[model samples]
Target: MGRSRGGYSTKIHVSVDGLGNPLELRITGGEKSDITQGEELIEGWQRKDTKVIGDKGYDADKLIEKIGEAQAVIPPKRNRKTQRHYDKHLYKERHLIECFFHKLKQYRHLFSRFDKLARNFLSFLYLVSALFWLK
Candidate 1:
């Protein structure tokens, strides 16, 4: 958990399949940047033909290079000097991740951050994700 004006907080980072089912999940300090966990989320991913879609926060030179053969469909930040083009149609699929989060938040406990321990929270996350897979 991380301390901020509101209180202790944590960030849940998830990677989902093309179908919007979660593939991996990680917890980080609320203050941590999204890019910090980018590499680890896709570390052992072996799919070379897939497109890696993400929001602007995941846009970075190292991450783009790390994507290797997989096409990085992340949009560049507004402040970037060079505006790189990405497949707009593919980028639209990013809403799947947003939808997944909306569903995850519907669970009151997870939404309210009742679990103080990260491990407990993550365990519940795994359980919930498994439930999603079962559906």
Candidate 2:
């Protein structure tokens, strides 16, 4: 968990397939950089056709290189001097992960983080995710 003016918070990173089904999920402190978690999220990804699409927050050279065979569609950071090529068409699909977060917020406790322990919070997250998967 991370502390900011809003108090303790967390960031949930997730990946989805072309169909918008989640392939991976990671929970990190709200203060943690999204680019830092980017590589870990694809650690064991085996699908060659997989392409990771993320917003500017996830823009990092290490992540782009780490993705290896799988494509990365992260937009360059505003501070970058030279822009990198990204698939605009595919990057638009990154909204699927946003929609997932919107659905996750429906669970009141999750939205507020009433659970003190990260493990417990993660358990509920998985449970809620399972519900989404069932749908």
Candidate 3:
């Protein structure tokens, strides 16, 4: 879930490569925690050890543990006085996700909450993602 002028906009979280190609995507409520959706997206999908990257929103300890060999490059959230560590260089790769969202929002079905059911919305989301991957 990401904050926007429309308030908390529902995000269809996705994992992509350097080219912004979709590998997996999961729809999350506008107010849901990013860490809550992390493992769910990767379960049964990871083919090998992978590297996960995100902003401070995915900085939960449990989510990091679940990812195993896949390193999390999540930055520490501000206002957390406690000092923490992350891979600064690797985290730069998170731009891929930003690029992916930019492309996704270009689609009408994806940018707006038109479908009544989550399943239907997810179906459209998947269809769009498939098309992105095909190109």
Candidate closest to the true structure, highest TM-score: 1
Query: How close to the true structure is residue 7 of candidate 1, measured as C-alpha lDDT?
Result: 92
Model 3 TM-score? 0.81
Q: Rate the local accuracy (lDDT) of all candidates.
A: 0.90, 0.82, 0.76
Per residue, candidate 2 scores C-alpha lDDT tens digits across 8-125 of 8888888776666777878888888888788778887635788878889888888888888888888898899889999888888878888888888899999989987888888888
RMSD to native for every prediction?
1.1, 1.5, 3.4
User: How much does candidate 2 score in TM-score?
Assistant: 0.90
Clashes of 2: 0
Residue 9 deviation, candidate 3, in Å? 5.1
Clashing pairs in 3: none
What's the lDDT of the predicted structure labeled candidate 1? 0.90
Worst-scoring 10-residue span by lDDT in model 3: 41-50
- Give the residue spans of candidate 3 off by over 4 A: 1-9, 44-49
Give the better candidate number (2 or 3) by lDDT.
2
Candidate 2 residue pairs in clash (backbone atoms < 3 Å) = none
The Cα error of candidate 2 at residue 122, in Å, is: 0.7
